[model samples]
Target chain A: MNLETPALIIEEGQVRRNIAKMAGIAAACGVALRPHAKTHKLPEIARLQIGAGSKGITTAKLAEAEIMAEQGIDDIFIAYPIVTEAKLERLATLSRRINVIAGVDSLEGATAMNETALRRGVPLQVRLEVDLGFGRTGVPYDHALELAAAIAKLEGLQFRGIYTFRGFFMNGAPTLELEAAGLEEGRLMVELAERMRAAGLEVRDVSVGSTPTAEYAARVPGVTEVRPGTYVYYDRMQAVLGSCTLDECAAAVRVTVVSRPEPGRLVVDGGSKTFATDVGPGAPPLHLIGYGHILEEPDAVLERVSEEHGMVRVPEASPLRVGDVLHIIPNHICSTVNLHSRVYLQDGGQMRELPVAARGAIT
Target chain B: MNLETPALIIEEGQVRRNIAKMAGIAAACGVALRPHAKTHKLPEIARLQIGAGSKGITTAKLAEAEIMAEQGIDDIFIAYPIVTEAKLERLATLSRRINVIAGVDSLEGATAMNETALRRGVPLQVRLEVDLGFGRTGVPYDHALELAAAIAKLEGLQFRGIYTFRGFFMNGAPTLELEAAGLEEGRLMVELAERMRAAGLEVRDVSVGSTPTAEYAARVPGVTEVRPGTYVYYDRMQAVLGSCTLDECAAAVRVTVVSRPEPGRLVVDGGSKTFATDVGPGAPPLHLIGYGHILEEPDAVLERVSEEHGMVRVPEASPLRVGDVLHIIPNHICSTVNLHSRVYLQDGGQMRELPVAARGAIT
Candidate 1:
């Protein structure tokens, strides 16, 4: 079947290979591989990675982990701060189905979790999130220690360990340098874990990662696990960071040219809805090359995207035309993948005939 | 259920009230109320509108209509240009379940439709989209007569009527003047319909509208239908255009404070995802009142939002704590509603929950 435009397409072969590479790195360092399923919410893809020797799955929400557990995947980790009552109930409900770990950054948040867990008669496992560099979320680096110690004293909660996302390590100098910074961050977590263990708390699970720091986390001796989500479907940012090549990107959005409203401008069906409006820090202007690089056009980038229209400014010499199909590697694969309801699995270089199951996991 | 923060919360009472107002306007105009379901894909909402006297439902894609059909909605119109094979198949499938009216612009699009109708043995109802002003989609108004003539020649296809989305017409002029322009556009469509009928084609359907032009369309002599979606959930753009008051908006995204890194800054769980980045042309700069106007402080605008963080830079003297739930009116209600998995519905003043059913209708 010809899959529709603005559709997410994932090659099973490439994804399996990528999973193996990540699992291998974790195995080499004696670290557990908890691949973040938020990148590819499709449980089938999660199963592929789980089948290939993963410790468990990592989610950004409790609802997502519950969905995974319902599908028979037990071990789950929610790497997000859940404080709201609705999510706490969802987290509590999921404990009966699997080994769930939720993230926390504040003592008030921990105390709330402890109270909720006690009320539900289930011990909630929490991994305190430390602010490394990505200042979006997480406690301050110094405050992480205080939060961890506070979590250690909280009742009806398990202080599994401490975790930090090295999204800031995505770009710096070189891959080796990024890895070294990642190592330093991991060492800090180890020291924090030691501090918690000395405080009479069981701190066995030391988790830290992201696609950029996957290799670095592997070499961190004291880290018990690594959480790399986008590795399952490496994106343009990953390629720019020397984390993976463009060819290693397993996920791509297929779109069809619908209009040539003006010269040098080709309007495609896939717009912000298909590709997403994620322009991470330092992102090259979408229109500079393209909003996303055209997989069919090795040198072409999707310059800009409106709501229902993607304006692909092509060079006068380019051979692209209206009605022609093209694959796009979006800037951030996870966000783009989340935009679509389903993904098609293609065999290596084969056509995406039928839709793969477990695609829309919006929890 | 504790509704998800940064969630699309629909006031069911107000939404039903808006639907009744539009349905009454269409009924008074003697035109069918084919409300565009692209605004809120909830089957329950669609049924309520249809039950209140709408002639049918309208969608941007066959996939959306199909989703609505699963929840028992019939008589759907796809008002966007669809030319791909997969889309055509879905359109045909939808036609079997309901009376599907697909939009066409060029001869190529018409030929594809003719071929699909012939190949599938189904008479596909077609709506010729007339581009009155919005340069995004539709055949040019100057070429409408030629396209209508050509469409009349196609076999196994019924020319339902002509339609144009008077989107953002609120930006055109003041209320009365803009309504006059809308009437003029309606008169043009009436003349176009007469021209189609002169060519021996049935011109029973002459649809032209949007929230801004709904009041004017109710009086246009030759208009047979009005398609206004946003009236069900008015936005800041609508309120600013004098279409409705802030209190009349049927939808608001409920978001809780997630971070307060700085004293004057309040980070909420809602960001571009729930709020949407759909700022129309000539629309006021978001938060000119400062990023977004707080729901509690019908006085203060939210101000700015990153991908995952909403920057509510408030007065240091303000008592906006880190856990206060705030309701935010989106710049465009349609896009904000589309960003969620479900809409949290409320009755009267208290929020009662309901499923969105058709949230990810992006096929």
Candidate 2:
């Protein structure tokens, strides 16, 4: 292929297959699929997911939802606690035109959104994010019922459901046992929903699941929907987590060997700038040995990276030349995709470029 | 400030001060300052550097040089090796318009550039990158003279000088001894240049130095130029490395506290997507304890980051509330700047936006 190095390449077949497989799993489990659009950040991929039976799309920021809305995606859940007045105003405007669901974990954020909804004359749909062990965001599980009741009482807001994100945790512990962790995540969210219902609050949706936990979590009785983003393009981390086989991984970065610096070391044209450093080589749970896995030469480990160069360590007898081209499956696809403006899609023998329309929508 | 959260903010006065200070350092050492544009990736800032007496600008890719050239910056040094044919075509086109220099650490890369130059009938100015123990790129120190001689023999290539990047290393060991490491980096390059000169090669430009090593490296007698990219916007890593003070950090990400998840944890509206993960919290030499430093709450540590949320560990008695704005100095400015599309420049009371024009120019 006569293409530049450090280019993001996505296999059309693998993407479609992965999307269908996840959608099938969700359907069999009687759960809606709301694939996180933040993974690809491409309207085309979002459309494909929607075509394959996704109920809606999930984005981490309102700016990303606005872009998706502009591309004619009607349902978007901004799965973040957006507090700023400017963003609230934009969210209110977006809610007027589409089914925009806002995430709120505190009364301060709910009150701000309620005021904006009242002023704009558009009732905002909100979901209470529960802190189910992953202590990043969301209201504590103990305080979630009170917070949900308070948000439901707000004049211009409709408390639709509850959601939480616990990627792979079993009984508050990070674990590799996907089934056990996923079931716990689903049960916790379901139990919270039942509690909210008993308290005379309407809790229609119970959303949970990440790419690693979606299959098992969705199989649990009460998980209404799954929001697995990276399943569309599984990466090295997912492969190690046993969520998907390496063959099912769709996205790979095409890079050229720019220098054979030593007998055992080869440097490529991509580095942290090409494949992001969000998922490290030796991160816990999945102690991935390298920055990425080279598909052509599985023995070669992309050991280190600077801003613009990837230092690959290979066996001394390896025949990789200075100008050899290789494909590397990054450790995390979402962060890697965010680093590029466009990606090349390979459909059989044909190749074309697609803009990552919401690439820098980090507002 | 009525601005969106997770916005990159740069102080105009501090930027000017940093530019002047680095230029002054290079001038004092009788070396030319060719500030690396990869840090800012802004033509406006490149023009400012040139206006502040920078000899030229250095970029990591030819595409960035093309962008800089189009913006009327006449001289550029693509500090990375250009190996692919597609990039060589662009490099040849860029070379025709400006004083463009290419980096070569291997014969294969040089031969490709030589073929392109020969085909286009343009002499490509080349610099030999020597590996002085960084172990990332560049030819090995023992083989530098041979590579230089071979590169000099290329028909369409002009061997101008030698350069290497060894940031904060002392006698092949990573250390916090800045002065010793910087001087050693400079002396090694100078000695290699002397050897190449003795072998009857014209080594006019012995370029070396990174943001942490530029001051001492430029003081070496034979070092003609220095390329310190991040000195323009000193980040937390630079400050910890003794390169700059916290007050000298010109760029910061303005984020708002969106959730008080626990008594000791405050979640902000920024994360790995906002402040990149390229430079980690516990990286060596500078064992930075957090993702970033919140200026308002010096005791708080921005401990963990998901895609869109930063988990800050703060004091129990802290008075920081949701919707309160905070500015965080990132660990690495270059990677952080690359994550944004535009940045807000604050000039006293006035504020404006500047595009990161060459942000995704990885090829």
Candidate 3:
């Protein structure tokens, strides 16, 4: 295909298989699948997911949601707490065009969004985010009902549901203990949903998902939807987390070996700017070492990466030479895909370029 | 200026001051200044550097050089080894429009470039890269003369000079011992230039520079040019390395405090996608902790960064609220700048947006 070195290659068949697998899991668990668009950021991929039984798409920022909505994606869930007036205005405008659901944790944040929505004469739907275990954002599980009630009472805002990412449960492959933890977290979220509903707040969607805990969390009785982003293109992190195998990874970075300066030392065109310095979510296990898994030389370690140079150290008897091509499975596919402007889709040995529509929309 | 949160801010006055300071260094050392465009990819910044006594501009990638040339930057030195045919063809096209000098380390690479230039009937200039202890790429210092002789004999290619980056000496700020090491490396490059010249090769330029050793490398006898990119926007890494004071840093990322999940733990909108996970060129010392230096709270440490969330741990007495805006001096300004699509220029308190023209030009 004469693809350029350091290009992102997405095996279309593998991607479709991944999407179908996740969709089947969601179906088996009786939950709606709305994959996160922040991972691939392509409307084409979002469309494929929607076609594969996804109800909508999830975005991490308002900018990403706007980009998706512009490309005919009608339903978007921005899983970020929008705070500023500028973003609120954009969200209000977006709400007028599409079905928009935002994740809000605080009463003040909800009030701000309500004010914007009221001023813009648009009805805004919001999901009260709960900190199940990951303490990054969302109201505390103890305080979730209170915030959800406040959001329901807000003038122009509708409390649609609740959303929580199982980031704290993200570690190595799901152990029996980890599965039990996920089940307990799921029960807590279902309990929160029941409490919110009892408080006269109509909770429709109870969202729970992370690549590691998606299987367990989706099976929760009251969880209505799952938002597993990395499942679309499972990476080394997902593999190490026991979510997928390395061979099942749909995306890889194709790079040219530029320099072999020493016996076991080789340099590739991709570096931190390409692969990123993400080992995995949470702490990596002992088997998951190095920055990425080199497909050409599985034993070779991506030792270090500067902006534009990735140093790979192989065995002393390595047969790697300059100008050789290799593929790298990144540690985190979401951030790695976000780094490139375009990604190539490989379908039946034919290559097609897809623009990463929301590459740097990190608002 | 009521700016958006998680925005890149470039202080115009400080940038000019940094430019003038580095240009002054080059002038004092009797070397031509060519600031690298890879750091601040804006052509506006390049024009300013040239206006501040720089002879031309330097780019780390051919794509970056092409961008500069499109914006009327005539003289460019792509300090990266170009290997592939697609890049060679682009280099030929670029050489036809402007003055282009590429860094070459191998005879085969030189032959490929020479053949492309010959086919296109365009003259291409190349610098024989000498391994001055960086060991990333380049011909060994002892074998550089032979490669230079081969390149000089090739048709349609001009052997312009010998160049080396003092990457090994790039650690903390110029200690006396580090300066001596820089001087020693410079001498080795100068010796290589002499050896090439004696072997019937015309060596017009002897280039050496890195932010840490620019001063000493420039002062070496017979060195004609110096390229230091990060001097345009000094960062926390440079400050920790003793190259610049915190006040001298020209660039910062302005972000709003988004979430205060717990006591002593705050979350900002900027994360690994904004600040990046770079602690600068060499290993960080003890005092240099965290991903960036927070402006409002100097003692606050950016402890962890996910894709879109930067978790900050401040002192127990932190009075930060939900919407307080703060600027962060990134650990490595170059990589941080690359992440953003636009950088705001603060000139005399007036805000102006400058599109990062050559950003993500890693190919």
* Retained true contacts (fraction), each candidate: 0.14, 0.79, 0.34
Candidate that beats the other on DockQ, 1 or 2, i.e. the better one: 2
Specify the CAPRI tier of model 3.
medium
Worst 10 residues of 2 chain A by lDDT: A166-175
Q: Model 3, range B243-318, lDDT digits (tens) per residue?
A: 7799999999999877776678878888877887745223434256777888889989887787788878888789
Complex DockQ per candidate: 0.26, 0.82, 0.53
Flag clash pairs in model 3. Answer: none
Q: Which predicted model would earn the best DockQ?
A: 2
How close to the true structure is residue B332 of candidate 3, measured as C-alpha lDDT? 87
Ranking by TM-score: 2, 3, 1
TM-scores across all candidates? 0.85, 0.98, 0.94
Which candidate wins on lDDT? 2
2 versus 3: better lDDT goes to: 2
Alpha-carbon runs more than 4 Å astray in model 2: A169-172, B170-172
Task: Write the residue-wise lDDT of candidate 2 on A285-361 in tens digits.
Answer: 78889999999999999998988999999999999988889999999999999999889999999999988999989
lDDT of 3 at A254: 94
iRMS, all models: 3.1, 1.0, 1.6
